[model samples]
Target: MKSTWIALLEAKYKNLKAPNYSFVLDEIGKNPYAKVVEDIRRGFSINEDTDENTDISFGYVLFLAPGRDFLLRISMIAPYAFLAKIKERGSTSQPIVRENTQDAMELDVLKILESHGISMFDEKSLKIGVPDSGKDSKSLYQWMFVDEEIPPWS
Candidate 1:
C-alpha cells in the first residue's frame, strides 16, 4: 500500500495545471527511484503575428523512496517571449534574476511539502545551460530528502 506521503504527492501533482495548458505525467518505477515527471507546454504570443507564438516546455520530476525521503527536480526552458523580456530588461541581469526566481520557487515548493510534515535534507540549484531541445537553455533545481518529522532548529 502506498504511504500517506506518496498519496499526498500524487494528489498534488494530479491536480496541478496551468491556464490554457495541459500537463503530462510520466511515472517511472525503477529500483531506488519511483519517479513521476509532470510536464507542460505553454504558448506565448511575443508579437502581434499569431504565427509567432512560442512554446515553453517545463516540468518537475518527483522522486519517491521507500522511507521518508523524496526528491524533486525542476526544469524550465524559457520561451522566446520570456527571453525577449529579459533582454529588454538587460541581458546581463538574466542570470541573477533566473537564479533568484528558481530559489523562490523551490522555497515555495518546499514549504508546501513541509506543510505535510516533510523535512528538507539537501537542496541545490543547477547551473543554467542549453538543453537538447535547442531552444533556450533550462534552469534546473533539485531538492532531496523529505522526512515525516521536522528537524530541530539549530
Candidate 2:
C-alpha cells in the first residue's frame, strides 16, 4: 500500500511544478544507490522524484531501525513544519512511541539533520534553520520546508 504521508504530500502538490533534484543529487555524490548495510540507518528519499523533488514536498525521511516507510502527516501544524504520529505500514494501529522522548521518531529525524550540521533551528531564533549548502543540507531542508520562517510551533 502507498504510504499515507507520501499520498498526502502528492495530493497537496499535484499541480505545482517539480523542484530541482540535482541539488540533492550533488550531495549524495556518484553513489545515488549507496549500499545498504546498516540494520538501522537514516535515509533521505531521492530515487523517486515525487518523493522529494516536488515544489513543496521538502523532505522524505525514512528510518531503518525498526523499519522503513513513514512520514509526518502532510497537514502542517506550523507553516513549513509537519508533525504527527506514525503507524506501521498497512496497519491502522497506534503510533510508535517510546518511553524516552530522545528515542522518539521526531528525534530520529532531527538527529539526522543535526549530523549534517542543521539544528533545524538557529540559536535564539524561531525561524527554520539555515543549512550548509555544501553539505547539501539546503536540499534536505528544501525537502523539509517549502519556505523559511519561524515555525508556528515556536
Candidate 3:
C-alpha cells in the first residue's frame, strides 16, 4: 500500500508542473512493521518562485494507521506564502470551546521539499504547535491556513 501511494505521488509530481508542492504522512498509534516508528508523521513543501514572478502553489499529504491499513490524504495548498496557521477545534465541553492554532510541521514536508532540491533558510521556518490534551495520548488534526503577511525575503 505504501509503495502504491509513493508511486502515485511520483506520477503526480511528474505529470503536474506546479511551482510549489507539499506532502504529509501520518503513522501513529499503529503497530510497527519492521523497525520502531521513529516519526509519527512526515510531510514536504516546495516553493519555486522567490520573486513572485510565478503562481505560488503548495501540496500536502498525510497518512493515518488505525490498526489496519494506513489512511492517506493528499492536499494542494495554493497561493503559498512564508507563514501559515492551522487550527484544531476541540469537542464541546463544560460550555467552553477550545481552539488550537499552529503551522504545518510534519517532518516529511521538509524531506519532500529537499528531494526536489528546494532550499529552506532555517529549521524554524515551519512553526506548528499541538495542544496538550488532558489524556496522555490524543490525536490532534490541524486545519491549515496561510498567514496574512508576505513571507520574509531570504
Candidate 4:
C-alpha cells in the first residue's frame, strides 16, 4: 500500500504536466467523504465533529494540477492513518488567458492516476457512507487508495 501511494505521487510529479498544481495529504477519521458533504452543508466547520465519531476513519492524500486550458484531480484514501486528494481545473473561455487549461490538464492527470494502479469506485461501500456515484462520488483514484497503512517516509 505504501509503495502504491508513493508510486502514485511520484508518477504525478513526473508524468503530469501543468503550470499550476498542488498536492495535499492528510489524516482523517472514517467518513471523510461524508464529512466533506457535511462541510458543504454546514459552512465548512471542522470543530463540529468528533474524531472518535469517525466510523470509517482513515487518511487521505490528494494531488491537484492546473494548466492554462484544463484541470486535474487525484486522491488516495486509507483506513490506516493517511489521506491525500488532488484537484485541478482549466479555462475554456479564450486563448489569451494565462493558466487557463485546467480542465484539459485535469483529464490528463486523471489518466495518470488510473495508469498508476489507482481504482475508481461507482458508489460508497456499506461500511462507509461514501456515495457510489454522483456529484461527490468517489473517483477511481479514491478507490485505489482504500488501505490505511502509512509509509515509512511518513
Candidate 5:
C-alpha cells in the first residue's frame, strides 16, 4: 500500500517540469519504515535572467523502530543561500544559536507533516548535526526528530 505521506508529496510534485527531477518512495518489507527521496537536477534560464544550475536533493525517512519508537530523519544538501544567511549571523560553531536555528526549521517541517495528519507523541527540538558530505568533504546537516509513540495514520 502506498503511504499517505508519499501520496501527498507526489501530488505536490505532480506538476513539476524540471527534467531529471523525481521522487522515490520506498518501504521496508514487513518493517515499519518508509522513505521519500527527492532528487532534483536541472538548469534554469529566462529570456532576461542569468542561467542557473540546480542540483538540490533531500530525503525524509520515517521509522517505527522496535518498542513502538518513532523517528523521522531528514537529510539535505544545505542550500548556499541558507548557509550564507547563517554565516551572516555568526560561525556555525556557535552551538546555542545554531541549535536554535535548526530547531526552528525542524518545527516548521514537523508542522507541515502534522498538518497532513502525521502526529507527534512529544514536544522536543530536533537533533541536528553537520557532517561531512562524503562527496568532497562538504558539510551537510542532518535532522532527527523523535517521538515516543506513533500516532494514528490519517
Candidate 6:
C-alpha cells in the first residue's frame, strides 16, 4: 500500500541527514577516490514531487561511494529548492546566511526530473540511512528509510 511515491520517498528518507563528510573528505584528500572509500552514504534515485501546490522538488545527489563502486550523482542548481519553499510556506524569512538550510540547490524549481520514464541513478542499488540511535542521529536525520515503510532501511 505504500505508494504515494513510496510515501513521499519515505518521507524524504526519514529526513535523512549525515552530511559533513569533512568537506567531501577534505576534497577527496589525495584523490585516489580517497583510497577506495568504504563509507559515505545518501542515495535515492529520483524524487520528483512535482507541484500540486508547489513546495518544490527535484533530484540527483547520490554519493554512495562505498568501496569505489562509486556514485557521484550530480546536477545541482538547487539552493535547497527555494529554501524548501521558504520552509514550507513559513519559517526563515530572516535567519539564514548559508551555513546550511539544506538546499544549496538554489532554485531550479524542479527541473531535470526527465519525466516519469526516469533515467540513471542506479549506482548498484545503494541505500544507506541510519538513525534509531547514536542519539537519534544527533538532530534531525531521524532515520528509518522504509522497512515495509520500515522507517528502518530494512
Which ranges of candidate 6 are over 4 A from the true structure? 1-20, 25-83, 87-108, 113-129, 139-154
Q: What is the C-alpha RMSD of each candidate to the true structure, in Å?
A: 18.2, 13.1, 18.2, 17.0, 17.8, 17.2
lDDT of 4 by residue, 1-154 (tens): 4345434434533322221112222333233354343322332112222222222222222223222222111132332222122223321221111133345433443344344443332222212322344444332233333222221112
User: Which candidate tops TM-score?
Assistant: 2
> If scored against the real structure, what TM-score would every candidate get?
0.19, 0.29, 0.21, 0.21, 0.20, 0.20
Residues 13-89 of candidate 3 have per-residue lDDT tens digits of 34222312223211111211112112323222222222112212222222322211111111222111122222233
Model 2 lDDT on a 0 to 1 scale: 0.33
Least accurate 10 contiguous residues by lDDT in model 1: 76-85
lDDT of each: 0.23, 0.33, 0.24, 0.29, 0.24, 0.23
Model 2: CA > 4 A from native? 1-54, 66-69, 72-85, 88-100, 104-108, 121-154
- Superposition TM-score, candidate 6 onto the true structure: 0.20
Q: What TM-score number comes out for model 1? A: 0.19
Candidate 5 Cα outliers beyond 4 Å, as residue runs: 1-103, 123-154
| lDDT tens digits, residue span 1-154, model 1 | 2243223333433421212212212221111111111111111111111111121122222222122121232211111111101222222122122334454433444444344333332212222221323332222221111111221110
lDDT of 1 at 34: 13
Which tens-of-lDDT digit does each residue in 5-111 have in candidate 5? 22332353442232122322211122122211111011111011111122222222222222221223321111111111112222222222233445454444344
lDDT of 2 by residue, 6-66 (tens): 3433344342135233443343343222232121143443222223333343333354345
Model 5 / residue 31 / CA error / Å: 10
| Candidate number achieving the greatest lDDT relative to the actual structure | 2
Residues 1-154 of candidate 6: C-alpha lDDT, one tens digit per residue: 2143234333434333433212223222333221111121112222222221211122112321222111122211111212122223222232122333444332111222222121222211223323333532321111111112221111
